[model samples]
Target: MKADFLLIGQGLAGTILSYRLFRAGYTVHLIDDAHPSASSRVAAGLYNPVTGRKMIKTWMADILFAEIEPFYQEMEGFLNQKLLHPQGIFRPFISFEEQNEWLAKSADDQFEGFIKEVFTGPQFPGVNDGMGGLLLKKAGYVDIPVLLQAYRTWAKSQGLMTEAVFSRNQLKRGKDGDWEYQDLTAGGLIFTNGIRAKDQGFFDWLPFAPVKGEILTLRQDFYSSKIINRGVFRIDLGNGLGKVGATYDNRNIDLEPTAAARQEILDKLRQLIPEKVLEILHHQVGVRPATPDRRPILGKHPSEENVYLFGGLGAKGVSLAPYFSRKMVDFLHSGEEPQKEVNINRFFKYI
Candidate 1:
């Protein structure tokens, strides 16, 4: 058997990259055991242009946001599912100082496109926006699990996916610089295996700071079309269903959803709104593949010519994966180099 690429892991990174490669007329065989708690499987899939405590525009927001909606919409059409939610984000002001700062930023030319409204008075009712908030455009959440499952079903039907664990022992380099794994021989291999890569031998030299996060799904009377983001993001999932998340813990390197995290989110939610939680429908935990500098890991392995790595998307996986996947696919399909920030070659000296 032969393929243009043999991809490891069917997480969001692998799924998107495989789809992109397939669309570009390349054969891609994916191997994944389908872990029950993979990060992509549990992600809320929020894509916001503005982020962080300082509340500034995300890096390359213009480029990343431009590719996001169209890319997810294309997948939605292909999968025949409504996975992309186009609701804008509403971030409440924490202090009068912050409100004043945003009022000034709203008039800035840089934020003109993404800024929907700068509320000097109030934005939403039945909420704790006494000082008002900034309504941002071109931001929303993707139903990641739905999209991943749809893609998995489609890939299985096409016989392009194998459900199994992938290890270095199964790989052998051919004389022509291709890779051979079991019955198939492929040109190259790419690893997008999330936190599992931390223990993988080939990538141990690369710095991976795995951060655990927890989120909750609640059934409440608070039904709003817009996503409210303050300390924690509150996304309305329709039909009195809402989602609030996520606590980032870099120190606690475990997947258990702690009671502390739950309390933290609850406290933050109360601070945002005075709504009563009807029921705690679900609680989930997943570890994000983060890095020291919080940039993505892309490009081929430094020593191995045919092996590649793509991850370190952290909390922004939903917003970053699609755009970077296209860039990585182009790099592999041709000799195009990824941007200096995300390219894996930046850490060559440390390795």
Candidate 2:
């Protein structure tokens, strides 16, 4: 088989990048093992403009937010599925000082687009927002699993995807400067694999700080249109079901869900809302391919010709992927240089 590009992994990074490349009129083939612990399958898929305990604007919020919704909506049209949910996010203030800070920010022109409302008192019932909170626009969660499954089915129908473990040993460089894997040959090879890239030998020198996270799905009666995010995030999945999560553990990097993590999330959920958890529906765990700088890595490989990477999205993949994947596809299709902060050239010194 021949293709313009051969991609590794089919998680969020791979899925979105391949989609963009295909839309750009490129022939692309993917090799994905369908790993159960892939982070995109287990992520809560929340995209918030303002995050963290400080409640400050996320990195490049303007550019990323602008592309997120429209890109997903375009994908929704292609797949004939409802994937993007722009339900908005409500972050309750942790302290009186925080409340005062947002009250002043609400008037700032810089925050005019993102800030939907600044409540001085409790706005929603069952939520623990006595000092009020900041309601944000253009913030919501994507149904990642649904999108991935839909894309996988589409890729298979088009004969663009292979389901098998990718072994670097089987990959060879042909005399024509093309990559040869099994019977497949491609002009370029891109690695969109997640934490697996850390041990992939080629780009292992790059610093990768893998963090393990766990989330839980619970059966509850709490109904809210907006996502409640404070100590933890509570996303109402509807039909008397809501999802709350996630516990971040950098030290313990494994796929197994721990009882302690579940309790931790439950405790944080209690702090955010007074909802009762009638039952625990599911528990999931996945390690994020985070970098020390907390920025995604993309662009061509340092030494190898026609080799590239588009990983290290970390916890913000839902927001970062749509924008950056377009950037990656452009870099691959043309000779465009991605932003220096996210470009793989930033790590050339280490290589």
Candidate 3:
């Protein structure tokens, strides 16, 4: 089989890039074994313009937010599924001082697009927001598993995807300076395999600080329209169900859902809201492919021709993938250079 590009992994990074390349009229093939612990499958898929304990705008929020909704809506139309939920996010202020600060920030022209409302009092039932909170626009979660599954089904029907473990040993350089893997030959090969990239020969020197995160689904009586995000996040899934989560632990890189993580999440959940948990529906864990600098790594390999990487999205993959994947497609199709910060050339010194 011949293709313009052969991509490794079908997680968020790989799936988004492959779809973009396909849309650009390129023949692309993917090799993905469907790793159970892949971060995309386990992620809550939240995209908030304002995040963290400091309640500041996320990195590249303007550019990233601009593309997020439209890109997901396009994918939804293609797949005939409802994937993007633009329900917005509500972050409660920790103190009166923080509330006053945000009230002042709401008037700043810089925050015009993202700020939805600055509530001075509690807005919902069964909640604990006494000192007001910041309501943000252009914020929501993506149903990542549904998106990946639908895209995989479509890709399979088109003969663009193969389900198998990718072994580097079987990959060889063809006489024509292309990549040859099994019977497949491609002009270029891209590694979008998430944390596995650290061990994937060509880009090991690039610093990858993997962090493990765990999320829990619970059956609860309390509900809210907006995503309640403070210490942790609570997403109302309707029908008396809600999803709360995400404990970050960089030391423990394994996929196991620990009791400690569960307790930590519940503790944080308590701080965010006063909702009672009726039942614990599920608990899941995934190790995110984070970088020390918290920026995505993109572009071609320094020594190997036509080899590239598109990983290091970390916890923000839902927001970062679409925009950066478009950037990557442009780089691959038109020979355009990606920005220096995200371009792989920045790390050539380590290589």
Candidate 4:
């Protein structure tokens, strides 16, 4: 019943963090309900180096790529599963202006290292695609569900997992300045509870802009066997399967996917190709734990000495989690501070 750390939630953050802690020789007990969500479970797990409308490489793509290149490979040897794949995304130009901008940026030294200089001019096999799009050279996808499930199975076999919802009421702030759960106690606990942390008592002070994302999984036989990279992700998906995602809805009154929303994805997908026959295989939804400034939440709770948290990874969990997790783990064990952007205190007026 006692361990070194009590981890809440088993999403990508928890999964990676738990694995890290375990490797570091710490006993970690993970607790979660394992419901479906688009953040990790439903995410396409695409790692886009440059993002946004301009299609620029993401911040620190080079450093993150170096740190991450072998990180997943090290884990594959341990887990005996292929968790990360080195693939590129073909972002089809959405507009004539976009095409112009892509060409202009391709020569820009700012994007030189992240994206390729030349791409096969817009052409598709029988399927008309985009006008033109930049190739995300270093981008890839992490099979998050496989990673989650593999870690879950591993953690359970090690008796470090529990299938249950973590409630704050189960916590007791003791006079010893350590968190308490039942008769066991740890150095402290971290609230990596994903979107559910918005309701967490004292942690409520953190600003979180929850955005719902939806993805549709399709079974296609004719799609290119290779990872068909395209704008918004039209991958070959391999293994007689493909996943098309995603639409962001911050103003959704309901949490369910709608016909219009499904059509919206279809409409976007059709812009390039002659609308392929896409059947509604399955749909999933999850609230992304976003922030006003689009950074991750990491560090200790302000007033709670030993209590800590690691959440708000947003849509970039696949690309950002491993690097940031190492940073947070370093901070937790060595008192190091998080990077300026990911430092959770930035969003909090006072932490």
Sorted on lDDT, best first, the list reads 2, 3, 1, 4
Q: Which segments of candidate 2 are over 4 A away from where they belong?
A: none
Going through the candidates in the order shown, the clash numbers are 0, 0, 0, 7
lDDT of 4 by residue, 1-351 (tens): 777788888998888887888888887888888866537777777777877765556777777777675888888888999988777666665567777777777778777667764443565463454465566677678888898889888888988888886777888876766677766577678777787775768687777788888777766444553244444456556654667767788787246878877777667666544546446577777778887777888988777677778888888887778898999889988999998888876766844
| lDDT of every predicted structure (CA atoms) | 0.89, 0.91, 0.90, 0.74
Worst 10 residues of 2 by lDDT: 195-204
lDDT of 2 by residue, 193-212 (tens): 98787656888888888899
Better of 2 and 4 by lDDT: 2
TM-score of each: 0.97, 0.98, 0.98, 0.91
Clashing pairs in 4: 49-58, 50-56, 50-57, 50-58, 93-132, 128-272, 228-236
lDDT of 1 by residue, 1-351 (tens): 899999889989999999999999999999999885588888999999989988789999999999999999999999999999988899888789989999999899989789999887776876788888899999999999998899999999998988898877878998898999998889988888876775667788888888888999998888788999988889998888888999999898787889999999999998887799889999999888888889999998877788898888888998999899999999998979999999998888777
Ten residues in a row with the worst lDDT in model 4?
A: 224-233
- Cα RMSD of all models vs. native, in order, equals 1.3, 1.1, 1.0, 2.4
lDDT (C-alpha) at residue 254 in model 3: 92
Candidate 3 colliding pairs:
none
Off by over 4 Å in 3: none
Report how far residue 342 has shifted in candidate 3, in Å.
0.7
